[model samples]
Target: MTLIYQAGQAQQTGQIVPQLFVSIQQPSQVALNGVSTQRIGIVGTASWGPVNTPVGLSDIAGYRSSFGEKQDGDADMGVAVSVAQLQGANDFRCVRVTDGTDVAATGTLSGVTFTAVYTGTTGNALTVSLSQIGTSSNWQLTTSHAVLGSRAYSGANWSSLQAEVSADGSAFIAVTLPAVAPALATGTVTLSGGTNGGAQTSVQFVGSDDSDARTGMYALRNQGCAIGFIHGLTDTTLAGVIGTFGMSEGIYMIASGPSGDTISNAIALSASVGYKSYGLKMMFGDWLYYDDDTLDTVLISPQSFVAGRLATLAPSESSLNKQIAGIDGSQKAGLVSTGSSKTYSSAELTELFTAGIDVVCNPVPGGSYWAVRGGYNTSLNTQTWGDEYTRLTNYIAESLAGGMGAYIGEPINGTLFGDVRASILGLLSDMRGAGYLDNTGTTVPYTVVCDTSNNPQSRTAIGYLQADVQVEYMGINRFFNINLQGGAGVSVTVSNG
Candidate 1:
């Protein structure tokens, strides 16, 4: 009799019987897909939701439903998301931060305790009521909130009433019934004692990165976020810290200085930080006057606006000359603070830029519209200063990191090198096709080398396989100059094709 063994199963050794062994192998060609470069990550305070847990938000309604509305401060996560949404950023991974003093609002009615779903002052707005249905044995339970709206449940008995509310209840509150059922009664109980905790410091915002329990900013790791910002954070001391995090995690971080800060102060702060990296983009605090739903017109930091604008652009595009949406005016231009409209002079802007600071102001190089003056990061190196360098480099690096693991266990041979090189070339070609890479003319925009030259016998013996890649990113037109000559006696020359 003939016997067959499944793939990956061992066959008996030295057996006289005939046996057939089958083996299955993964496809040699690996297709690399580009990671999403548009998703923005935000770490900030909120009135609701689990603390330090990353939540995906696509719209303002989802943000409100998950994280509650904007709190009464500048660090609200919802406010950041709202402003970012104005710049056409629809994808977000938001992490809510809170001090340990936060408390969930709760109330008791008919021997049932209702608690807010998450810890925040937004729970204080909830009210629950129980009433008899038309004087019958049946009863009705209703939960209401000003922002979350209202929901009602009807049931013939206590058990049924609890089930109905549990099945289709308000997302804002959770109902807990007592051990013993109580008779239905008509009364309203309002939740109170809810607190939003204290303001967060930079340490809390950075959070811990323990593999078992990540919190705050570290909670956003591996969330596929290409850009991130900590709302209202202007601490110069922490710039390098956050910049290092961004560099290690392949995320671009947008940071800012204090709103209404002076030019000298901004320059001094940048110099004091002194840490330069392409992973971070620091903005000059030309505070913007933004209309908030809860706080009315407030002067807010410029990080969220910058992050949103970057999120709306392609990986290779720059923020310079790109008009930012939903900005009522800036402190300098709108006269909100000084009672007089003041714009940055060329010399003042030059000083700020020289100090590695960028600002959003009126009269961009193109026109009088408000736009980013310089599309640059904190890096002093000219080669890596532009926003494109950080974004496109991270985009390509992350794409490879996500796809190159397939060759880890494969045999180290010529076929492995060819596959690896081909995979990288494929992604680079796609990038070129998508206008992310370009050269002067009639030349390939990238180069890939993976073979015996770079990977010798000594390296392959130790299971080391390396593929070196070089890509030329498309350049942004930062400056445009024109020569003009006009005189009555001067001759004009015209050229025709």
Candidate 2:
């Protein structure tokens, strides 16, 4: 739908004569160029007024950038002109001197020289005179390398020194002397006649590396003062003695031997296998001798050990003799010889009585003389050899004494059983041929060898009979007999010739 406009807001209508008539309209914006007609001003009033423009690039009409222009400093973007530049700004003023007329061509009165005289005391009372030295382009102030001068005292001019300082001069703390330093080439800052000068105590150096580290002699003297560091004492007094003697375990001891006669160990004089020494000259442990040396070593052994050396040679006493004395080994009654005389020293006796058998056994014999007897004696003569023999026969006859009867002796103590039994038998056999009967008797051969069973009853009777027979012939020969009997048993008797 078409809308109608209000009266003042609508467009004005012109004559419709078609002479190409058109109403003109101003553009929404004018297209202008070059400098604009605009006042550059701030938005706030001058003293008290309303604002019109903002002080910024957007409020200005045209602007261009340039690169060459800079601020207050060099091209470097650092802060410029600190407070120090104001120090000497107007520090001095000049009074112009002219010839009372203008000189036309004098370019700003030539040039100017600024001089200020200072009136202060010389800094160091005693100055160090220094000079250049060495091939390098530097200076050295070392005491080891510094050249020394005779006398330097108070009021000495320090101007000739390497560098100057003030009278209250604590400022010159130290001066570095380079390897090529030219100062102190011919002068030195010496110490004299003060707390630390002129016949003063020596200076010392403390250890530098560590507390326990070893240092120079000066360091030891200074640091070890209260430490009581003592040095080892040498024995000069005994030095001569030490020279004469030899050393062992750090001790000087007298030498073991003298001159050319010394040997490392003790030596004995031994004869060579094929050579002999005819009276030797001798030297021992500092002792000298001709032929016989008093200083000789003797070897000895203990008593018990010495006794053991003789053990194999000595012989022991024998107990075999007592055993040979106890028993009868034979029954031939006569004077006869038997056994080894060297072995069985005494005569052995043989006796027989009425109950005697007709045959017997003999081991060794001289021949036949029967040591036999027969008798009847009353009154109970217990001392009767015949009666005792008869009793032995009775026991034998009854076979109560086994088949044989034996008489054995009272044995000596410590006697061996074998020798006692054999000797007793040997004794009785010896009596068989001893002619002990006071009349020679024919030997009755008893071939019956029988066992006497250690029967005490038969052995007593036989032993008694042998004792009586021995007693009866005691005057003829001091012989002993051990009689044995067999009852009525018959056989041929034999002997070892």
Candidate 3:
């Protein structure tokens, strides 16, 4: 029998036709019984056969000659399956073939669970219902749209807009949403065109807080609101338009030029409270009873003066010295006090006041009084001289009457030890000589108290007595000379007078 190959095809069988796949087998002399070897368009054919007809079969089993040719010798006889026929059978297809194995559904969103997906040549759109369960159930929508405005950039385009959401909708704050994909250079990118239109609308009932961490609005909704930045009012052409600026409050506006817009009363009110910054100006007010910078035009009652009672004089040499040395006859008293009422700055009047303070007596009528004629500092950290300089300068410059005086001794106790002692003696002597102390040149006992309690350097006790000389000078009858005479005396009388 000649083995052949057959390619199977679906036939209109009353019963379900089982697909047959056949190949040539070895039986050279006789064909398998009850098997119809159908030729499959080629010389090689296939047919149904009994299960055990061709037993002990091999590639070459029977030897015979075909088509009236008797075989005297073998002529390379063997069984072979037609590779082309086998291939055609492999490519066979069944009617109404189910294609559920290899093909996949197109356009699957990787991490999204879409309740419904609409795909078309136009575009693909996914409808995701917020789920209380799966990842598709709960979600945060990220979009690029400006819900709030910014001064830096304008227009409806939200290239810089951001949004966010939370569990609570009422407190739905603004958030920064990622920017949408830019339009392709080709232009006209299609979105899902459906009843939904593929455009996201009220996906969120309300927006959350702003995600712009630098924005003033973000600061307010957050906690401490401040914009430590500068922005331009116009297009960002030149970076020079903006500069480094700061504001404490969340909301602030900068304006320039004298426009019709006046400053809000809130600004002035806040300024009075604390240091606040505006565009170019700053407002400040204090407890000194000032509401605004401008002077109040309203008529108001004058402030009443508060009087100060003088401290009681203690019985001490320094106190006595201070009493006598500080004493100056009134402008109208004694003689027509020949003195310069004209005051001068410490630098200008330093010589006169210094000389008077040193000599302990300046008989120049009204100029003889001791006063703080201010001085200037020659070096750093020595404000004493500067203070004196400023004081004397200001007093002489501003005084209505009397010429300014200088301190008799240095401001510090230890610094002017001898000067202080000598100044006391000289001042008392000058007073006595001028008859301001007494009517004659008799050596009058000027009770001088030496209290060391307030002294910086103490020797014996916190409170103790130290003897100091008290001298008296006289205006001589001859030559009208100012004479300085000294005499030795001891502290003997203690009268508490």
Instruction: Please report the candidate that would top lDDT against the real structure.
Output: 1
Error of 1 at 445 (Å): 0.8
Which ranges of candidate 3 are over 4 A from the true structure? 1-415, 439-443, 450-497
Considering every candidate listed, which one attains the maximal TM-score?
A: 1
**Per-residue CA lDDT of candidate 2, range 176-257, in tens?**
3334433223454522211111110111111122335322111221110110100110112222222121111111111111
* CA-lDDT, candidates in order: 0.86, 0.20, 0.21
TM-score of 2: 0.10
Cα-lDDT of candidate 1 = 0.86
List clash counts for every candidate, in order: 0, 52, 39
TM-score of predicted structure 1: 0.89
TM-score of each: 0.89, 0.10, 0.12
Q: Residue 6: error of model 1 in Å?
A: 11
Per-residue error for 51 in candidate 2, Å, reads 99
| C-alpha RMSD in Å of predicted model 3 compared with the true structure | 51.8
Candidate 1 clashes: the total is 0
Please list the Cα RMSD from the true structure of every candidate, rounded to 1 decimal place: 3.7, 67.6, 51.8
Ranking by lDDT: 1, 3, 2
